[model samples]
Target chain A: MARLTKIKTRKKGGATEILVLVNHPMETGQRKNKKTKKKIPAHYIQKMVFKIDGKEVADANLGPAVSKNPLVGIRVAGVKKGASVKITWSDNKGESGKAQTTV
Target chain B: MNTIRRRTFLKGTVASGFAAVAATSGLLRPTEVMAAAWPKSAFKSKKLDKSIKNLFGSSKVTASKAIKIKAPIQAENGAVVPLTVSTTMSNVEAIGVFVEKNPSPLATSIDLTGATAFYSARIKMGKTSAIHVIVKSGGKLHVAKKTIKVTVGGCGG
Candidate 1:
C-alpha cells in the first residue's frame, strides 16, 4: 500500500520538531476545473492528532484553506530518541489515514 | 400536563438520535460525534474578522513581540506558502492561522499538549493578503501577522 503520510524530525531549540506531510488533495470546493468548468467539492483533512509513545502531543483542527498535501511541524519537549510517533487524520468526508515513525 | 408533553418530545428526539448512531456503531458513535465536532460556521466564514470571532470567540486581539512568524514576504505560488510560528510563551493552549483573502479565512487551529509553542505548516493563499497567527496563552490571545504577496491566487482555476 502507498503511504499516505510521511514524518521527519529534527532538533530545534532544545525540542524535537516533527514534520508531518499528509497526502491529500485539500480541494477548497471553490476551485474550478480549467476545462470542465465545474466546481471541485471541498475535501480536506479536518482533524489530525500526533502522539508520542501513545501519549498525545498535538491535536489539530484544520480547515479547507490549508494547502494540498498538508505539511505540519510541531515541537515537543524532552522527546527521547527512538520514541515512537504516530499521526492519525480524518477528512471532511469521514475518510481517515494514518502514518507512524520513530524519533 | 405541559411538563409531561415536553419530556415526551425530548425523549423521542433523543431516542431517534441514538438509533441513528446504533445503526452505525451498535452503541458507540465515534464517527458521528467526530463529524459533528468540526466547526462548520468557522470554516465557512469568508471574512477575516468573522472567522477570527468564530474561531477564538473575539476579534479583539493583542500583538505580541515574543511570537515569531517565519514566512516569506512574497510567495511566487499561492498554492503552497510555508509558514511557521514559534513562541517563548508559557502555558500555550492553542494556535490558529488565518488568511485574510481566502474564501474561508480560518486555515488551521491546533491544541497543544506537552508542547514547546512551535508549529509549522503550509497554507493556501487565495491572493495577496495578510496572514495572522494567533496563539492562546495564559487565557489571552496574542497575535502576529505577515503580509505575503501572491502572484497567482490559489482558490480559483
Candidate 2:
C-alpha cells in the first residue's frame, strides 16, 4: 500500500507549530505474517525533515520502535501566517513521501 | 510456523548489531546514506545505559515529575502503541523515547529547535517494557518512564 503523510500547521504565539502523521506498517522485520506465518521484512521510516518557507527547521531519526503511522509535532520560531511548511520522510525500503501546508 | 518465525527473529536480532554499524558506515552506497542519519550505536546498544550515553552523551538523567508520558497502562497489541509526551518545563531542546526491554533500547531521538514542550509518536514493543521519555532542556536531562504490558507482539513473535 502507498504510504500517506499528513501535515498540519498553526501559528502559536511567535512560532509556527507543525504536526505530522505518516501511514506505514513500520514492520521491524521481526514479525510474522498471520496466514503464511513467515517473518515480514523490516520496513520503516528512518528519517524525516521539517521545513518552514523552504528553510530546514528541524528533523528526526526513527527506528522500527516507532509505531505504525507515526506522529510528530514540531515548532519553528519567527514564522508568520501563510508561511509554507513542508515535511518529507524516507523509509528503509528506499521509499519516500512528503506533504505540505501553510501556517 | 511458530518455530520458524522464532528462528527468523533470532537471526534478525543477531544481525541487528551489525545492521547499525553498516547503517553508519556509508558503505551501503550513497543513496542509502542519504536516507540514513539514525544514530547507529544508540539504536544498536542492548543496554539502556549505553544507548542513553550514546545518544545524550550522558546517562546521568534526573527523574522529573514535570514530564508526563501518556500511554495505556495495558496495551492490547505491541505493534502500535500510541504515546504522547508533554512537559511543563520550558526551553526544551529535545525529546527521546526508549523501551527498556526492547532488543535495542533506544527507539528514536527527536531534535527540537524552537518547539514546545509536547511531542508524540507510535512505538513498537516486543513485549512488556517501560517507556523512558527523556527531555533535554537548559543543557540538563530530565526523564520519566511508564511501564506498559503488551498482549500481542509488535516485534517478531
Candidate 3:
C-alpha cells in the first residue's frame, strides 16, 4: 500500500491553519521503466478536500503535473482549537486515502 | 452541545446566502455540501487554452507584472519541477498553475482563504513549455508566464 497523507493543524488567534502532505508517485505515464523500458501508466491525485469538524473549508484540484508527495498549506478563519481537521484525496486510478489531526 | 449549535448555525448561514459571499471569498463550503466531485473536464483537457477556459471560464488572460513565478530556468528533471507562485496583489482568492506543454495543461488549482497570496507545488513537465500562473483576486484575473526548458525527458513516451 502507498503511504498515507500527513496532516497537521495549529490554532492561531481565532483561526486554524492546516497543512497536508500526500505521498504519491504522480506518474505522467510518459516515463519508462529502467529495466523493462515499458511506459509507466499515469497516476496522480485528482482532488483533495480539507474538512474541519466535518465542515469543508478548502480543497484542491490537481493533475499529473503535481509532483510526487505534494504539500499544501491552508488557513481557515473562525475555527477554534481542538477542532477536527481531516484531509482526504483521490487519485486518477480511483485510489484514495485520508488522514486526520486535531487543532 | 456547542458543536450541534455550530452545525445548525452553519446550515442556516448556507440557506441565508452567506455561503455565496464565502464562495467569492474563496472559502466555499456550500459547494462541498451540494457537489463534492472535482471538475473532471477541466483537469482532463489536453490543450492549454481549452483547459484554461474550462477551469476559469475564459482563455483570455492578460500578462501581469504583479505575479511572480519561482521555478528553475532549466529543469534538471521534468518529473519533479519545484514551483512556487506568489503575488504582491491583495485579495487573492485563488491560484492556478498551468503547464502549457503537458497532456493536461492544468497542473493544480488551489482556492485560498484568510488572506493568502502564495501557492507552491511540484509539477511534472513532459517537455519544455510555458508555465502560466493565474491569480484570481478581487473578482479579476492576472497572469504571469515563464518558459522552462526541460533538460531530461520525463513526460514523453
Model 1 lDDT tens row, A11-65:
9888899999988898888878878998876678888899999998888888887
lDDT of 1 by residue, B1-157 (tens): 9997567566655754664455345353432332345555567788888777666666789999999999999999999999999998899988989988787889998888877798889998889999889998986889998899999877767
Tell me how candidate 1 scores on lDDT.
0.82
Stretches > 4 Å off in candidate 3: A8-18, A32-39, A75-83, B1-36, B113-115
Worst 10 residues of 2 chain A by lDDT: A8-17
Interface RMSD, in order shown: 5.9, 4.5, 8.1
Local error of candidate 3 at A19, Å?
A: 3.7
> Against the unseen true structure, what C-alpha lDDT does each candidate score?
0.82, 0.79, 0.74
DockQ of 2: 0.43
Highest-scoring model, lDDT: 1
Q: Which sections of candidate 2 miss by over 4 Å? A: A10-17, A33-38, A75-79, B1-36
Where does the lowest 10-residue lDDT sum fall in candidate 1 chain B?
A: B26-35
Candidate achieving the largest DockQ: 1
Which of the two candidates, 1 or 2, achieves a greater lDDT against the reference?
1
* Model 1 TM: 0.84
Q: After superposition, how far is residue B130 of candidate 2 from its true place, in Å?
A: 1.4
What TM-score results for chain B in every one of the models? Answer: 0.75, 0.76, 0.74
Candidate 1: which stretches are off by over 4 Å? A1-3, B1-36
